[model samples]
Target chain A: MANTQVDQNQVLPEYGPVTPADIRRAAWRHNLTLQWSWNYERMQALGFMWSILPILQRISRTKEELIANMQRHMNFYNTNPAVGSPIIFGAACALEEKGQGEVADSLKIALMGPFAGIGDTIQAILLRPIVAVLAASLAMEGSWAGPLIMFLFGLAWFALKFPQVTWGYKQGVNLVTTVAGGALDKVTEAATIMGLIVVGGFIPSIMARVTTPIKYVREVTVDGQLTEKVVELQPALDSILPYMIPIVIVGFAYWLLKARRQSPIKALLWLTVLAFACSYLGIL
Target chain B: MTYGIGIALLLGIIAYVAVVMNLGASCFWHEALIVGAVTGLIVGNVELGLMIGATLTLMSLGMWTYGGATIPDFMTGAILGTAFGALPGVGVEGGLAIAVPAALLMTQLDVLGRAITTLFIHGADKAVAEGNVRAVTWWHLLGQLPWGLTRFFPVFLAIWLGAEPVQNFINWMPEHIMKAMRVTGAVLPALGFALLLTMMPLKKYWPFALLGYILFAYLNVPMIGIALTAVAVGILYINLKEVRARG
Candidate 1:
């Protein structure tokens, strides 16, 4: 009834109808168990299938088909939750209706790895630290702008969550990958450089601070006269390398973590113990 | 140190809702600043909340749970830290010290909570076999129960039953011990940075990391300055790499 003289020759493709409501529901399901139901067996398979359940209902011909698709989607799956899954899932929905079930499954599996890389580099490794550190620095300074700023950035990034899926669906793999596909590696590389720089800057400002108040208060004779001169050791160290001890501490931690391949939790435990011991003995 | 019954319950509910946000991909509520801000509001001390949250944020700067590997649960710590830290004389530093262990311990709880979610996943599987779409949705939401309670119980205990002992412990800690904890707190971020380095690897970016250190450590550039410098470098690198790809 609502059709305004639709052209008879339009010949829409025989694919699953992706309404706005379907996308909305899919987005909701995609995020529902994002951080919650992650497991060893199937990382995001459960949640991934759940997100497209509404679409499956609309597209599948039989109960067996729906169950089969659901079971297949439940296969080992994982991705960077922010941008990767939505894009891939959107394409899968499109392909599913086109009777390219195997292609859809393989595509979902393949696309996740690179997208995971991009998402991790861009969001977790790059954007998170920059925003959180800035907010933290400001919060440390007792400014309300800290949390406010972090929230705004976080909100903006989140706003892109749904759009990623829709954009992928509309453009499909060819155009979408062409646009940002080649850029993933480049983006990941550039993001790594930025992450390193940020982490480097973070060490001295917040991470490491080793200072001692023990002043060299020995009596010295100058020009045959008895005079007492005091030189504090912290300033001396600072002159050579401001926050040098913190740098050394980070260096040691880096060695323990990377070269020795020590567990991070163990390293953290050791640091805690070292901090207590250092403070007790005044070595740090 | 104390809240009215209504306020106490309300705070518990707010904290409950906040961790629920973690159920989805949007990580807004779990951020240290946001958690701190929430608790700070409940306790009527936004400054204390920001301070506590900022401290936790720095400590957790490098933390990201990759491949379902469990890490310290700082979100719960943030809530507890701010709540306890807001008390008179308890202070932000002391509360942070308390929060440190809380976060580490909560990692175990987080892992267990995720495991419990498997039961729900199984239910969803069964629901799918039965063509029970409604049941599948319910099961999915049911899994969040353990996830939500993992956060809620800690927060409730801190407010309902934990305030007095915690506050007393803070008041009882000697000044020197507090000083040591402060030192420890300052040093904790090193571990976070170390973890980040391990995950990302310095690789060819070692120089950029070094430059970052120099900019902040020697030249005294602010964090934003370093961030801006890094952004410029990233854009330039991207442009150059894109051109190379085209070539």
Candidate 2:
């Protein structure tokens, strides 16, 4: 939300004029530092670090030039937040030195939300899940693979981080321009494809029905043997159907809170009470 | 050292509380390792504990956080279920079956914890205004304590105290009831997927969704492989369009 409204009275802290050479050197230093501590602090610091990139890009630029700079910086930032933050900061610093303000500030605000979303998805959803699955599966088999799994996962984590940093440095502005023009669209397409497959995988993994309150009405006899072919009836409306009840209730509550403009807490509270009542009344 | 039900349950409670509090860096693996090791120590099967912990972690691989929201907390479920499942006669599969429901039940606690955190955000603001860094830290920490405890202690007590009775109940449960639980386990993921799908902007990308589903569900292609193929195809499509525009 922070924009380029720099107060003239407030003396801006000087960090010297940014240059391509300076950016490249700073990026390498950042990369080395990141390789040291891959913890939460590093991650949080990375967020703050990348946030300043667009501000630099906007200084002293025409509206069109500003938009172009914004798009380019965002592309680099979007690639990977943890590693990309310093690279972006350096690039922004270079732009700031070049006196491009409008481009930098606009891009900063526009890209923050998307960058955060992408970073969380890649780290939490894709990478972490894959590592957890592989490690856990191996561990379950009684193999002394716990340490091995951890090491391998850590390797993959770094493997994914460094390339983005190098790419940002080598390509610089070209990277952002390329991404804005066509590369980003391709990435989104790929993300969509990957997301769909993940969803499909989740179907069998998460949403397969567990229980129905249906009972067999009659047994079929096949060649003097009783076959378990019985007509089942849906349990009377609800017996607190575990999975289904939660989904419907959450959906309704979310709709009320998000779409209908009801207070979120109020909606959640009401839904919880309703759920409890339905359970008590033997209807869910 | 051989541990009893009480000790195992206590460990579960502790692990749950620790994660809920955010006292340390607690991921699913960390939670499982802590709980499983404790349970294993109690049950005289530290090795088994590690194995079960690892397996459950894998089964929950795709579980993640989007924005600030996370998939259900599988840590307590994994630990308690594994402990229960690893009883004298119970095996890993049995433990898994029990753990799955326990994990599902813990979802409520997770949600509640987040709600509590929302309250603390205001307190954090107040602390910031007062320039009381210590007060702010304490408030945040205080806010997380209940969240952590609820995750650990209550569930620990429930599993520890109720294990024998629950196991007995399971032993006496009708075949149909067991079948129902299995069915519930399988269907739960579908609901999770549904939740995820509903939030996605798929109107313009319907074909990709269909293609992915078909490839995975019917054609039985690996997910990663299919994803790679889609990326390749998309790159080509974009390039072709670019060429046409230039021409």
Candidate 3:
């Protein structure tokens, strides 16, 4: 989507260094409050400003400068917390320091959707679940290390904080400019494929255990005399395909979600009601 | 169980507060095992707590609240469920059964918690007008209190009020209804996957979805095994795309 084709030899000009104190403070608060204070009008504006305050202080000479910078940043911003790299935000800080607020703002907005896409795919869809499964499995085996292991992974996110924020600052706008390159797209696209496959794989292992309660006592003539036989339904379906009922239920949910355009809440309420009613009647 | 009320209250608040303060990963703090571990420690039954926590963790496998959507409140469910599970005769399954409905019931509180944060947002607006940085900062952080309280109240009550009524209710539930509840519990997870499916930009990824289904349903592969397989599939797809693009 980038027309200018700003290549490697270009060596985009760098903004002056933000003080060490500013970087330290900003990086520390980066994860804080950003998850909450998510408002309707501007999702993470308050938290984003809170994160960059120290840098704004370093760059802006006057009260007017500070307020103006804060107001500009207070505009709408929402992103997946994990995959929306602090590097991107760091680059935006550099842009603002170089007095390119509008450019930085536009870049932030433009990058959020893709960041959310790739971020959700990797962090939400892939890594988090895998970690949970591994840790929980370990816990189930009577290991105290299970909870310890999970907490350690959580701590690993902090390890990402310093390196990324500093890298974004060092790379400045050059790194962000290359974000539109084909490489990131492939990463995102591949992640999408991986995510879909995982979701499909999980359908049976996780959700497809429902079985029917219906059974019939059938009468048949055997050796010229009446004979009674019991026929069952759930096992019949299971014989054809394991988790068949679950697949059908999940498929129905998909149809309801997409074709009916129902909200997740409404769909959940409906499913819960249907499950109870059907199970009550011995239909499933 | 010596430090009953105080410890239960603190841990419950910690679960929601940690998320707001960015002190913990949203994924980590919200997991049942973690919540149960803390609550279990409070009630002196860390072993039962861990198992109950692990059980709910599996139930919630692969579910995420992407785009900030509310799902069942697993944290509260774990805390309260494990507290009850700590009692005599209540095993891990019983704890999970308690958790299933508790998690469903707490979704409303999750919504209310988010709604209450708006007042702080408005307070931040006023802080901005006055150029009061302290006001802006504190107000934003203080919004977390209501969310913490939302969690704390229910958990404290469940533990403090005695587990008799809740246990009796579980016992009083008919065999048929319990069967139905379990059936519904199994189906509820599908809604989460479906929400994600709708959000995914499937484009050319549809075939891979079927491939996953066949691998799991026919082959009976475990989740970890399927994940490794997906990595291979993802790499192959990327490689082919590059080849076609070059040609």
The clash count of every prediction, one per candidate, is 0, 36, 0
TM-score of 2: 0.44
How does residue B227 of candidate 2 score in lDDT? Answer: 47
lDDT of 2 by residue, B1-247 (tens): 1235667566766665546423222232344543565566666676767766776666666555432333556677756765676667777777777777777656655544544444453444344444343554465345545456657664556565656654565458565433332322222222223333444555665566566556654566654455455556555656786799899
lDDT of 1 by residue, A191-243 (tens): 56776676677667654345766677878999999998998888988899888
Runs in model 1 deviating more than 4 A are A1-16, A31-36, A171-284, B1-5, B25-27, B163-247
> Chain A alone, model 3, TM-score?
0.54
Q: Write the per-residue lDDT of candidate 3 for residues B20-116, one digit (tens) a residue.
A: 5342245366678887787788777888788888878878876776545557877778887787777778777888888889888676566556555
Among all windows of 10 consecutive residues in model 2 chain A, the one with the lowest summed lDDT is: A34-43
Q: For model 3, which pairs clash?
A: none
lDDT minimum window of 10 residues, candidate 1 chain B: B111-120
The per-residue C-alpha lDDT of model 3 at residue A219 equals: 100
Model 3 misplaced stretches (Cα beyond 4 Å):
A1-17, A173-284, B1-4, B21-27, B163-247
Question: What is residue B168's positional error in candidate 1, in angstroms?
Answer: 14
Ranking by lDDT: 1, 3, 2
Pick by lDDT: which candidate is best? 1
lDDT of 1 at B176: 66
Per-residue lDDT, model 3, residue B171, is 61
Which digits, one per residue and each the tens of the lDDT, describe model 2 over residues A18-40?
55454555454344332111111
